[model samples]
Target chain A: MKLLQLAVAVLLVAVLGGSPLSAGARTWQIDPAHTNFYFTVDHIYSKVRGHFNTYSGAINFDPQRLGESSFSFKIATDSIDTNLAKRDKHLQSADFFDAGSFPEMTFASTKVVDAGQGRYDVHGTFTVKGVAYDLVLPLTFAGVKEHPAMKGKEVAGFNGTLVLDRLAYKIGDGKLYKLGVVGKDVEVLVTIEALADK
Target chain B: MKRTLLQIFFLGIGALVVAGGCALPFLYPTQTLWYKTGWEKAVLQTGHLFGVFAFLALVLQLLFGSRGALLERAFGVSLVMRLHRANGQILPLLVLCHMALVLLPEGLANLPLGLTFWPEMVGGAALLAIVVQVVAAQVRQRFSLDYRRWRSGHRWLGYTVLLLAAVHVLFVADSFASGLPRLALLLLVGMMALRLVYRMVSSRR
Candidate 1:
């Protein structure tokens, strides 16, 4: 019985220390070049897609310190593009971005919550068109890797998706005029390739 | 009596312009997709609402013209009249968007003045002349000046706009088909021929 107890204790120590869940903090810098901010809106009864050409942000993560992780990101309102010149101008007008009044769009992370396996729930305050709203984005812990250029740095990457009812956020007037020219529901997909900060 | 033809011409041509604006389709896979086709930039800012108001304007203008003419052709002439004027004034403004994208500085640099601005100026002049003629015919009927001069100038200016605009779109639109320009060129020639024949027949009578 003594021998069995000793073995059990040893196993427990090994599991606690060496497990992937072990606590170690990491901070990541978003690779702005590789990052993409993509969104889609309703187009003439069908779906049309678009994205911002300019956006920058960072994410910090540590599996052990799930509650401590945070992120901050911002996209330039002027960077919006819809691939059609006529439609793009209209989107930027007071009818949409009203970019002149609200020059920048931003996102600042508040806290992280423990979600299921290797997953997390990140809460952030997002400001768009000068309106601030809190959002809970479901995130997948993609794992950490040593920074290619920095010897002591490690980066944590993640893929996250959030559904935004632009209506709730007051993106555009939800009232459909002349048979729904704009769509209310918007899904934002973010793929972050963040570089670790030493 | 002559104003009837003018209204019909404006309505017909206005519908063509409006329909053309609506039918414009887009193709992509470009890096500067926004700059190249930046409709959202305009729509979000001012063009969207402008589009609504302009369409409203077209209907209004159409209704005003229809007051003394036939009302049996359309339903709710009041509403449609609002749309007619809204569309008429707004279509050209909306064209500014496509112009901003497709007619980038480089595109503008290459087009001849005739294809670029002169033809439009001629068209503008012709339109102004038509307005003057309409006023003169209504207000100065005692002068009894012949109408053919103004009509001739207006017709020539319209032809100039048609020709130059065709050349302009062919050179710049990038979407021009293999034979469409040639077909349009032929149609222009055929229309000119038919109109001259009609003029000759009318003069003989």
Candidate 2:
């Protein structure tokens, strides 16, 4: 009877561990209307700015256990808008995003480390045009609040910036690589406002 | 007195072209004002101004190329020819400045393969034509080529360069999108066409 009771206790522990309710953090879906992903690059003389219009992401977080939080995001590559119709078309071509073959860019965080003062270093794998690279995004949590429009719903806000090398990702090749008409480093700024699931 | 008037006329046109190119940023607010450095803006602006001046020099060369009486009345044949020769040497340098100002900022590693677009192809052809004209002039005596043959080749190449230049200017619509500058370009092109046609008809006679 003692051995049977011990086995039952072990089985109960395993069941509880595998349950989603036991997870430390809540899942929050990024609100598209409130989230913006902007990128800027030097265009020989001045900085050219553009933003991605379509993207979605989910953040799993618990402020008390920051290390256990993770984020996964996917961006539709073709939704890039830069004000100029012709230039936007060129950016979508193989010379830049190559949106046909690689319609989406993605990031999935493997680890999140607290860096004091509400800052975090999110280590993730960023995949672009089928090329995946390890990148660390320095993020800051602004605050969490009750949704103003939806009662009983919680919302969280975070912002971060990431710098990427175009050549490192093979975004530009051949003439573009040698011309360097566009700057090598591209700066990406992300502002995320996510809504917690009820 | 007529020669002085002709000089003033040409200088005025040259000033107009350069001023138009310079004023492009103001007429169209499309260009971004936020630059990392003032040098970048200066390079791009100077490059465009130099491009217009270079093209104007080319047009002057074409206009004064022949020793026709009508042109001689406005500016003596000898004076016209002298100005043409002077521009021939100076035009290449202006082109070099324009290219350097625009391209150097991009760095050396970004040399794409070869001419990929229509404007680029025409611009490349114009540059090549100028180089060939200079090289052929230098080597004609060495190669023992007939003077008439060399002159004919030179004239044909100059015309080709002029034609290619027109296409290059028109295709580059960033600064000349729509305004007085664009109107001026079209007027200049129309005047060039009339002059060329008149020259051809008179030469045939």
Candidate 3:
């Protein structure tokens, strides 16, 4: 009985002490050159798509303990590109992202829930035009592997989709709001490729 | 009688123009998702609206000289001519404003005034057509050209502007990809084509 009790106590101590330290979360920096953050919005009857040209982010991930992982991203509002120079300038102005006043739109994840099959529900605070909102971005892990170009380095890729309401951000208020010409919903698609630090 | 009709007609069109301009933004609230700022979208959209209005006015002037003149019976040829002159003078200013507002927002250096890509090429060609027409109209009298010859040249230039403008709008207009805007554009172009055909048949007769 004494031997059995000692074994049980040892197992309990090992389980409790090992679980937290075994998280093994690894940090990776976003490879901006390979990352794409694009969005689509309803315009009249069709959806118009565009991309942000500049962004940076970091991910702290643990495949085994996925719930403890975290992510943070920052995008330069002025880097908006829709293949139109004039349109981009207008977007950077006070009416849209207000790139002058709020140069960067950021997202920092608070909770992550692994939903099997390499999928995760990442809840974060997304700030744009100085307005912060709780947003849930559904992310899928593409994979992690040895990079061909970067010697002795590993890369991890993730894709996420989020739908946002423009009106919620007060993006097009006043007459434009009443006009209803611009669609209220904006869909964001994020492709992140990160390089693991040695 | 002619003066009263002319005044009333002008007053009615004036009201329509003012109301249309003010109500336009409210009617089409869905701006392109590509734009970051609402004001930017509004400015770009306003530029497009001005171009569309100018095109309509120019088309009306084109139809005025036809056999089945819509305004001649009601407003008299003199009043129609006056309206045509007004449109001719005002159109260049409208075109100037449209081009400036449309291109200047992108920054002067980045203006897509090139012949490489189709959209930019078509827009560039349209601007060129407008410039040619304006220059020709301004200098035609000084060149001592015969009235018939000058009128023929003027008609051809007008046709060029219409064709290029149509191409530019079809290619670049944001809401043109579907539904109402496309349908309206098709109807307007079709009517214009039918009038051109009728004018040709009558001239031959």
lDDT tens digits by residue: candidate 3, A14-112: 897666566456788888888989999876677778999888887998777666789888999888998875466666666667676788999999988
Please identify model 1 stretches exceeding 4 Å from their true place: A1-25, A147-154, B1-205
Model 2: per-residue Cα lDDT at residue A144: 89
Q: Fraction of true inter-chain Cα contacts (below 8 Å) kept per model?
A: 0.00, 0.00, 0.00
lDDT tens readout by residue for model 3, B1-205: 7767765886697576556544543554334434424555567667766776776766765765442454676667887777776677777777777777665545454445444246656766766776776677678767876878878877777777777777776666655556666676677678878888888898999
Native-referenced Cα lDDT, model 2: 0.75
Query: What is the TM-score of candidate 2?
Result: 0.53
Instruction: Rank all candidate structures by their DockQ, best first, as comma-separated numbers.
Output: 2, 3, 1
**What ranking emerges by TM-score with the best candidate at the front?**
2, 3, 1
- Stretches off by above 4 angstroms in model 2 are A1-198, B1-36, B111-118, B141-144
Clashing residue pair totals per candidate (backbone < 3 A): 49, 6, 15
- DockQ in order: 0.01, 0.05, 0.04
Candidates' lDDT values, in order?
Answer: 0.56, 0.75, 0.73
Q: What TM-score fits each model?
A: 0.49, 0.53, 0.52
- Summarize candidate 2's per-residue lDDT along B7-81 as a digit string, tens digits: 687678768766765665456433322221356556756676677777887877777775556567766778877
The candidate maximizing lDDT is: 2
For candidate 2, lDDT tens digit of each residue in A1-198? Answer: 999999999998899877665776778888899998999988777899999888888799877766679989999887888886546546776667887679899999999988889988889999999989998988898888999998878889999998988878988763443454578788999899999844
